[model samples]
Target: MSELTQLSPQPLWQIFAKICSIPHPSYHEEALAAHILHWAQEKGLHAERDAVGNVLLRKPATPGYEKRQPVVLQAHLDMVPQKNSDTIHDFATDPIQPYVDADWVKARGTTLGADNGIGMASALAVLADDSVQHGPLEVLLTMTEETGMAGAFGLQPGWLQAEILINTDSEEEGEIYMGCAGGVDFKTILPLEREAVPAGYQPLKLTIKGLKGGHSGADIHLGLANANKLLARFLSLHGQKLDIRLLDLNGGTLRNAIPREAFATLALPQENAESLHALAQEYLAVIKAELAAVEKKLAIQIEPATSDAQALTKGCGDRFIALLNAMPNGVIRMSDDVKGVVETSLNVGVVSTEADRAHIRCLIRSLIDSGKEDVVGTLSALGRLAGAETIAKGSYPGWKPDANSPVMHIVRETYQKLFNKTPNIQVIHAGLECGLFKKPYPQMDMVSIGPTITGPHSPDEQVHIKSVGQYWILLTALLKAIPEKN
Candidate 1:
């Protein structure tokens, strides 16, 4: 029993501790799902799995609250798997190691998984605690929401009995999210032309690392650096002065996160190596000064590298660098409706070059469908010009803000009454399953609320302890205030 279990709202914290012991990365949630099933069974709750692999467990309304309208607590089962380049932990098999740091709990050198794990834990705690007052409650845990809304997409119409949906996926406690942005993933593969390296060419590795990468959508406007974009720019800058051949290039991991590190293996003349090394140092200083505030510890290095593969042909290398440099990244537009909110943005999340092929992955987010399409068109056109294959997938609609939501009104009033402070209600820039639920349960009023979580989709992720207790209080209070069905 760590101190985390001793926190206020112990039920939620204890269950969250258990959740951290299991690996539930996107597309690899079998073990976690099984744990959930077994937990529900032990409590004699009616739990079943939908065809889409979502877990739904029902707890009958508390004795006196039976007549209130049923409510569904929704959260995703999967968490994004991200770690520092040197961390040895595996997302598929190894459990997340969480530690208390002052007011927040963070995982060591890796993403904390608190993004949805804490939300899921809150739902499970409600089912386990018998003394809680609540109307009929259904907990719906979806699958692969981090990689894509797989479970939400396969959700069958009329499957849920709830007339009201309370999504627990939103971060930042006290703020209620009534809507969110839509997103599209673009995967591109540019075929490479290879040729023999020039005589007496030595191999050197160019590295750009230690950038403070964050969520592609939520943190896109923070001016944090992207490793892929930086690597491409650095190489392109010096590529003109010297004819460098790329032996191998790779950077980033998931399309939803800003890349923190990137490196490339190059074949260059021994005499030209010193020039490249000097340039790398120069670029490092420039980058350090550029991102001093947001990205501390930025590092660039050039060291001896080992690679026997042939280097990319000069023309192919030029085209590859050009494509990446030209790709639209960062905030494209700001919301005219919501002050200081980003309306459209793109992240060049991952880029790599194999023996004969170069691949790049990008994520675009927009509050409106048209804005998303515009970026898609620009990427597709860039692909055509580069003679690369571009595939777009996993697109979900954006949730439009609804100011008249009954649940939102109740939540706002309840928060002010409880804490004597008004809560901020805004549409999030990140994608949420709320948009998908509106399809099946069109009439179901929804609102999202959760504890304060920072650095989601990245290794710096953490949850605030005090905010979690406050969130738990607000959630239970909302369930007790459910209105009776007419």
Candidate 2:
């Protein structure tokens, strides 16, 4: 309903509006891809969809620029589906409702999908606009980017002819990303023995919520509380004093996101319930003061609850607590090469109570392969000690920064020339499709840039209005400046 058509750089804004009108959450992007394929044909450009649903559109070079090397403008097709708890829209069927708020465009109680939608739109606009001089170009719109790098991984090698790739998925307008962290997810299954609730004990629930958990990689160093760790800390510290036994415990939703909420079921003597409450308050006070600046709404709720789930045996509970306390969670090392960048980190993202076993999901990220293995080795050894099974899956490589990259020089010079300000060069701790793309296209020079998007992957996501125009100008200029091939 919002008037995106009237936004500056009307060509780009118009395409963005069409994208926002579709429901294209991760892994459900066929309809949008079909629409784009048809639109590309109507516009008299060569376009086709690959086996994995990635759409590639080709545009010819202008008369004078025929000798320049071709460039691939890459953007993903899917968006992360997240909304406010009270919002009534379904991501699979409902169009995103975005509106201009001050200088930023935001959606109504949901993510704006600006993370890659803006990238896709800018690529589409470049393909459609003929007045801008450029060399031969190809636009690659990938699917299933949010849930994982499935689309990028499925892309076969030797399919693209472009020598350079320009990714429009980076969030900051004034920063160009040259590298990103590689990561792997490991699920540890800890088997704990259960026993009948003791006659003298009663059931109580320890609930923790309102922690501002963020991207496990980017915000790992922020010292945000992992709810699972917090819960385990309390149980481990007070289990003996209060004669505590665990029923089951769960926390977090995604392995790549910091755990925000967690709760544990417990059985303890009724006489110790009041003492338990007092201890919880005391612990809460200490944490509140420690995290006052970041976690303002941090809360821990204590309530009585009845459960048929048997409590973990005292020995099992104690061992479980010890395992949790030993699990690695948070930044492990900072980069020595890239100043202020995190080199290796681990997040205890998820802990779920299953029928027979408790499953813990952790994502480890590092700029170097050995760094990931080091953490994995620690986890494997701990799992062996606890008689747990550790399974690793979906390993992806990092995009190591090339100090001598040719494209990096061109982008930096162009940004300086266009805006009269030097852009920041960064190697992010988060995952990017560029990392995967490099596996097959090793010779392809790649750099990522985009308009400033704040609060990505959440209901508060917004994209700056002014930065969009600036981004477009830089992209247009960069394409023209691409030198002719040798």
Candidate 3:
């Protein structure tokens, strides 16, 4: 019930409010696309949707600026679906219920979708504002961005005539993203064989939660808590001492988001109960001290599990522990050319245990293809050593930075003039649609920027209330500052 008037004077927030009123989860964005199409038509701008439901709206240059080259404003229309355990909002049909906090705009209990929704809103605001001087503009909004880059990848070549693209998807406001790491997800399977629970063993459930998790790519280098890694560390170090039998294990929800919490159920000999509790406390202190500055609420709790007799073989438990320990979960290398860019990284994102099989999802990212393959090879070898099957899927190539880009000059000058300071130019360890788009336009010039956003893939995702105003001013200035083509 909160009104949009409480936000800043920028009209992008108004468009964002209207976008929140629609239900547009990944792969189900028809209604939102239709709404955008209607808005474009009302403005007398040419608009069209691709076969996969990606929408592109075109606006001609203002009368005197017709000689300038056209620019494409890009953003994804789909959003990652995540909600709190107690929230009852359905991503498929429920509208995002957002409210204004001191300086942030966030939803009640679900993901705010500001990742790219704010991008789409900014593009719309530009398209609707006629008084602003600019050259020809194309607003490209793609679908299914969270699950796969389907809309972006499936976009036909030559669909847009613009050679310069501005992506409004990066999280930081003052930074300009010139390149990004490519990535792929690998699904590893381990055949399961259940065994009868050994006598004198009691089932216990261990839950690791309350970690402040962030984007797997952006925050992976921060040495934050990954629940899967913590849980595996516990089992690896104490499996022999506790005489444990694995029953079920699971952690993480999304491949792109860092695993915040994980849980596992197992049966352990009652004789070692006190020893196991002490070990848990020891590990908790070690991890807490390590992540005290970042994840203040990191927790590890143990309780009796309500399950009948079910367990895994001792050999399997040991092997699982070894595999988890071997898996990589942080920044692998730093860029030599770009000062602070993460060149390579990996995330052991998801793990699930079932009666007949255990599955693990690992996401690997690297600016260099060789580094990416090297990480994959290391993980695959570990899986082989543990006798588990592994297969990689949805591999994407990186968008290497074009240092001699023409747009970079204008972007740098515009940023310096607006902020009174130089913006940091760097490549990110996260996946962006720019890589896929470049496949279609090899010579395309591109740069990414956005208002300040935090907790992008989580329910805590929020956008800064003041940065939107600054972002809009910079974007409009860039469009007008570009020299007109003859």
Say which candidate scores most in TM-score: 1
lDDT scores in order = 0.90, 0.88, 0.86
Top lDDT prediction, candidate number: 1
lDDT for model 3, please: 0.86
True lDDT of residue 479, candidate 2:
94
Tens-place lDDT per residue, model 1, 1-486, is: 386788878999898888888888998998999999998998899989999899999999999888899999999999999999899998999988999989999998999988898899999999888877999999999999988799998898878999999999988887999989999999999999998888898888988898878888778999999999999999899986777888888999999999999998888888898898788888888988998889988999788888878888889988999999899899999999887888999999998878789989998999999999999999999999999999999889998889899889989998998999999998888888998888887898999999999899999999999999999999988888889988
Tens digits of per-residue lDDT, candidate 3, 141-167, equal 988877768888788898988978999
For 1-486, candidate 2 gives per-residue lDDT tens digits of 447889988999999989999999887898899899999999999998788888999999988999999999999999877675458999899999999989999999877899889999999999888987889999999878766678898888888989999999888899999999998888889887988999989899998877777677767877878888988888888889999988989887778777777889899999999999999999999888988987888888999888999888888788888898789889999999899989999989889886578899999999999999999999989899888999888888999888788999999999999889999999998888898998889889999999998767667678999999999999999999999999
lDDT of 1 at 379: 96
Mark the regions of model 2 whose C-alpha exceeds 4 Å error after superposition.
Answer: 1-3, 84-90, 304-306
Worst 10 residues of 2 by lDDT: 78-87
Comparing candidate 1 with candidate 3, which one achieves the higher TM-score?
A: 1
lDDT of 3 at 297: 83
For candidate 3, the 10 contiguous residues with the lowest summed lDDT are 1-10
